[model samples]
Target: MNGSAGAIEGCYWQADRETREVSPALSGDIKVDVAVIGGGFTGLAAAYHLKVADPGLEIAILEAETAGFGASGRNAGFVMTLFGASVSMMKALHGKERVRQAHQYMVSAISALEAMIGEHAIDCDYERTGFLKIATAPAYISLIQDEIELFQSLGIEGFEWLDRDQLAARIRSPVFLGASWEPGCGLLNPVKWLNALRRLACANGARLFEGTRVSEVQRENGRYRLTCDH
Candidate 1:
């Protein structure tokens, strides 16, 4: 596995993390029931869940570099319930019902993440600090108010409008006009969470390979063969 410092140098999350052992690269041909490309959050979670569902299943995660060395570790790390750009935008694009369902799905996803962190006792510096959508100009105040009304029409709770004074109390900024506050929001360290997922997936019998790039994939007979540059 490529645990080299250069792989994690640019990302703040990965750079801040403590050094750990990296898994070895794939050596020679190997066979598995499932081959998951990329060792990011999605791949690791899929491997872990698949093993949980069926312990006998064989799974291997292939990564070009070390895990969490991509955007998975460099994101803003906001565990928010917002879907897409805005509620108004989503409703206009997918209609009211679909937007409501999407919002609900995001809410459920945040809940599931919290549950997983608690269940596994993952230390990721998680904080339920909530979210604030601030309006820096007078024109944006109406836009934010319209979004709040849209949320209300969709029967969504927990979102409220904070006037200039109220917002000032929370954050002392003169440029801010007003803001929308939602209680169902959180922040965490992305790289730490990724590392925890990697550990859990490995413990659940998922094999991970680093510095192993897949060059080609083809079907031979009834099985799929992956060509890699180790």
Candidate 2:
């Protein structure tokens, strides 16, 4: 399967074999602590987490294509800054101090991801080149400025507000009216990242079966039976 997202060009991982289109379904019954459905990040993460949580537990990953042959392989590798709820919502949900803590967690996650990459020696080409959020209208400037203030108030550094000239100087784009830059965000080849995770999963004693598709999974007498059709 070609896992490249809409505009991103390139596969998600390296292939050690030819692309023989095959959907060899599971044939026999298997048992495990968790039965993951997809081979994307969620599934892979689950498998990895489970293995780390308990090495004795059986973990299996059934992939229809090679590892990282899904959306996990084709994504804009942006560890997005903590921007989900508005500042108002953050204040409402947990107040200012808690909101700052939550933001810290987001930054922590990025650091954790980098640490994972280094600890496992997963060569996915990760970098902390920072991130830019551009505004297309003057109305958004207020919101952007508010964010900058919040960052400064919370002692979050490396965030800068870019005016028209600054924005133009940083990015040669005529559409943006202004922009917010953070030094904590960057991009990477997701395909390579996924592949590296797969390798780590294998090294950690997790069995990954590529080109294996699970057609039917039914519980029978407290045991799950998986049927594979190729």
Which one is best on TM-score?
1
Model 2, span 1-230: residue lDDT tens: 44322222354333332243333335566666667766777787778877888888777888766666577866677776666677667777777788777778888878878888888877777887788878888888878988888778877676899898988987877778888998888677676676667666766777776667778888888878776555
Q: If scored against the real structure, what TM-score would every candidate get?
A: 0.93, 0.73
User: Residues 1-230, candidate 1, lDDT per residue (tens digit)?
Assistant: 33544247667776655677778889888889999999999999999999999999999999888888778878999999876887878888899999888889989999999999999999999999999999999999999999899999998888899999999999988899999999899999998899999999999999999888889989999888999896
**Which residues of candidate 1, in runs, are more than 4 Å off?**
1-7, 219-223
Q: Rate the local accuracy (lDDT) of all candidates.
A: 0.89, 0.71
The numbered model that scores best in lDDT is 1
Clash pairs, candidate 2, are 12-191, 25-228, 25-229, 26-228, 130-185
Error at 99, model 1, angstroms: 1.0
The CA-based lDDT of model 2 is what? Answer: 0.71
